[model samples]
Target: MYIIQDKRFYVCLVVACAAVFAAIILIPNWNRLERGHGASPRVLTIGPDFTRKSLAGHLVLVEGVAPHEGIEDIVSGRGTHREIALSGNLALGYRTDETWLKVEMERADFRRRNLFLWMQPSVLDHVRVYLVERHGLDAPRITEIGQIGDNDPDYLWNGVGSYLILEYKEPVSQYYDLYFNIGSTSSILLSGHIGTVEQFNNRMYASDLTVGFYISFLMTVSFIFVVLFFRSFSKNALYFALFSFMYAVNIMIPARMYELLPVAVDMNVMDIVNVQSLILLHIAGALFFRQYFELWITNEGLNSLSLWLCAMLLAMAIGAGLGGWQAIMPIELGVVAIALWLYFFEYVRQFLSGRKLSRAGLLGTGLYSVEVSTYHLILIGAVAPDGPSLSIIYLANALFILLFTLGLIEEAAVQERRNRLSLNLRLARRAEQTAVRLAREMTRELEEAKVAAEKALETERRAQAEQLRFVDVISHQLLTPVAVIKSSVASLRRSVGEAGGDDAMRLQRIETAVRRLRETIDVSLVRSRISSVGGRARKRKVVLVTELQKIVERSCRLFPSRDVTLEFDNLDLSARANIDVEMLGIAIGNLIDNALKFSDREEPVAVTVSRDGDELSIAVRDRGIGVPVDEIPKVKERYYRGSNAASYFGTGLGLDIVNQVALAHGGRLEVENAPVGGLVARLAIVGEFDPG
Candidate 1:
């Protein structure tokens, strides 16, 4: 539960998080590095005029051309000389002069074959090519092969890419001479591709696949952002969607998509298309990041700078649409430099302030910054430009969107915590307000409840004391008179002296009635005590055999007519029981009395004392008419005699007292008709009843 405080767990978590970030950053760069190793060029085999494949990069660059140099000048060898350079210096770093590429096709089949020179940098302004003879000594058999740009065209206008295309009409099976002069005012980093028409189609297919993949990814991301923007109306989502759309367009333009389609647009339109989309893409990406990272709040200075960059960039985009792209190009440099420095300044400051950017944000902004610098540097003839802008822009946009999603999630969690805290604060305030008032109210109610409970307890104690007083009064006032009455009757019977006469019979009846009255009084008092809530039955180790023997002797002395028997199982064995001996004896006496009274004659009431499980059971079975099954349950109610006992005299408290005594001893009273034809009343008293 205390995981955050555990040092080892915290260390492991930090390591795991660091490892995840490392993988995200490094793995992609590794792949990029791997892909930087391009395949070696395949030699152009002299077979079909059109090979239906891309012209692999076996470039023969013609370097060191003057700014005003012509294709004719190169073929004539009249001014600056040309040297053969391969196309391997991919950076094309620091180009100060106009350059030409002379590709030598040495073998046969020059018959009506048109080899197109394709360049990928879509912003090139001029390109030229010439078909001429080697050296006949004169002005050098110079035929201009149709021209376009300063990088000319004896090369026909393939009406395709922003590249040099020379369509030639001279042919032989031997070596020929070709000359090109390439010049561009816009970022003139050119790579040459000379291939036949079938090869051109192949190149288009491959280009479409790659560019189309990127375009699809961008569009999907754009659509997703659009949906998010509509749902949440978030500025970041809107900006990101714009960023995706603009970059996707910029990417498509360089792939010569206009040429691929049958739309007949002018070269100026394509140039405007190329220039404006990239500029807008730059603006969109910056605004997206600015909103994403909350530049306004984070750093107002950077935010102002971003506004300035956006304004200037927008102006440049507009200029590109007009004829002012060249004039604004320098301003483009200043804006870029300021933006880059300010971006990094804000970025680092945010870090030092403990507000580090999310990985996606850092990666996206950093990548886009690098890409923008790379393009502009290439534009200003600073560092050499390598790789394509499309990849960098696409990746940057993706990362920025990813960062936005992560940031939104973080914000949601923070908002939830704040909301929960606010709710808790409200609850605490309510509780604080109610505490004093509710406490006073509860104290008053509890005081009243305490007084009432004390009254109840006092009432219960008085009732119990009255019950004990009643029991004492009956024991002295009632049982003594019954005993005196029995003694007087016995005295008179002794005076009459031992025979069967009317006086003897009447005295015998009086003595019997007196004895019954005494027994009933004793049972009544015992029942009262047992029925009282405060009844306390003092329990101790009552040896079963001894208690049964005393009970049998008492019963015989009390009732001289009936033959009473206590058929105790063992007298010598260690048979012991824990019980309230006085209460248990009373219960047993009541049961035996019921048995004797219910019997027809002096048929012995079998009173058996024995151990049953953890209880001592004294069973009194009588051979009289057994109690009716229907009145059995009510027979245990105080003073409720049974239907079968209509002819017999009983207080009914007898069985009730036995039942209560048994329950007080944590046992029970069981009544059942015996198998032989009798009512058996069993007083089961639970104790440490051990029968060894």
Candidate 2:
């Protein structure tokens, strides 16, 4: 059932059925068919309008060397030769002894016409034809028609095989004795045809077309296999190409196409090429099928056996050539025929066992095995009667080529489809593996990020708690000492009431030092709170001038010896805006304090409020030692002291805090050297303004 499903199975079945039917039809009357030309009589009579006649049963074969004299010696029985009657064409196997054929041709009621004699399988090494004319009581007129291997320019060639022009233009006798002396190292076949020149030419033309078409088909298939080999790099394709090309050349020898070659080919060399080409064809076919079916994998023993057989056959071919043992040809054909059947059955076994084998391969090899076996049987005289016609031979070859090529194409397509599916499956698996790996890596990275965020949040909570404790220590413990020192200095001033200059100055210095200490503590505590985690600006509506004036009064009270001046320009002093009041006050106070600490007592600290578009600028100018030009960029970094301000008694937190406040209010702080030779720090804030 599995084999029946394949279309090629039916095709092969049809061919087999046809062959069986033909055998059935011919087997019953094989004796009648075997007696070709109705059992050729003792004399072949050529009638008027005679197209062709076979010199079959009329021929008498003689072995060994005949007398060099004319046909008279043979006719008179004076030569050392034994005559044997032939029932059909001369099918003498390979022989080293010289042989001669004698036949009598009679013209009956036929007009004078040019008659020609045609001989087949032109591989004969030497041939001589002698025509003898006899009239009653007249001296026999003997003439040698043609000779092969004598290099005679007058020899007739029909373009298909050997021939001789009998030249019967004016026939003086109705009967003639034709003597043929033939010798060859190759198997000799003397199937002869006698016809007019027109008939001979017609047969030649037909033979030419058939053989030409077969050779052309072989050549085309060879070219196609060559292309396929290069495109796919398949060993089977290369082997098949070689097989096709060698087969084409092999057929040319039997068809006498070699005579058309530009240079004359010697019979010896042609024989060698013929034998070697057959061997090569066998080897190539074996290799092609071995690779096609993967026999090495499926049946290693059979594959090795095939290789050994091929090697043995190659060695035997060489020995046959060297020893001139032409008899080995039939053995070689038998061996190849057996091997073909073996491989065909192997394919059949695989197919029947449910293995994925190409049905076309089975069909092609089966048909091809039958064709080769039948052809070999015919050549070796195993077939009843003589060999089939040349047309039948050509048709068999054509059928083999067509079916074999179809099988190869089908197998190639199936293999390519299988390979493509395998490649796609591998690609899909690789893609799935890559996706799974990426997902795992992404999950790992996400888990790492989540853990890092939780750790950061815990660290922030601890830092905020520590900051609150530090602020508590500054407000209670640290500020208590400064307040006690201030109270003690006031009590001493009251106890030593209206004390003279030195004592009063000493007490006043103590009070000023205490007040400075408290201010430092307050600034440190405010910096801690403002820079703490989650610190953000809390905006409230307040009059601009009112806020600035309160900050200036506080700075002047803290530094009583330093003059602090507040000025407003380019805007209404009473304009109210939403800003962070506490943060802004702390920033302005630090700027004023820095101005008083860095400048001389005689120099006034100028605090000015101005407007530039929608921005509010609060600038503090002091004639103090300016920052180094190169160090100005680093001043805003936390705890960074400018190079020029190293001697100033202040922490680096002031300008840093001012910069942060400016950013929170959507503003910036600009620190630059004043044109009059001091540092001017300007705080610029952007806010919504309300007229007060």
Work out the TM-score per prediction: 0.57, 0.59
Winning candidate number (lDDT):
2
lDDT string for model 1 (303-341, tens) is 544565577678779877887664345345445644654
* Model 2 root mean square deviation, Cα atoms: 9.8
Question: TM-score for model 1?
Answer: 0.57
Model 2 misplacement above 4 A: 1-40, 62-70, 77-85, 149-170, 253-265, 293-301, 320-325, 345-357, 382-389, 423-692
lDDT for each candidate structure? 0.62, 0.71
lDDT per residue (tens digit) for residues 321-363 in model 2? 7854365565566667766776777677777778876666677
The ten-residue window of minimal lDDT in model 1 covers 28-37
Model 1, residue 564: C-alpha shift (Å):
1.6
Q: What is the lDDT of candidate 1?
A: 0.62
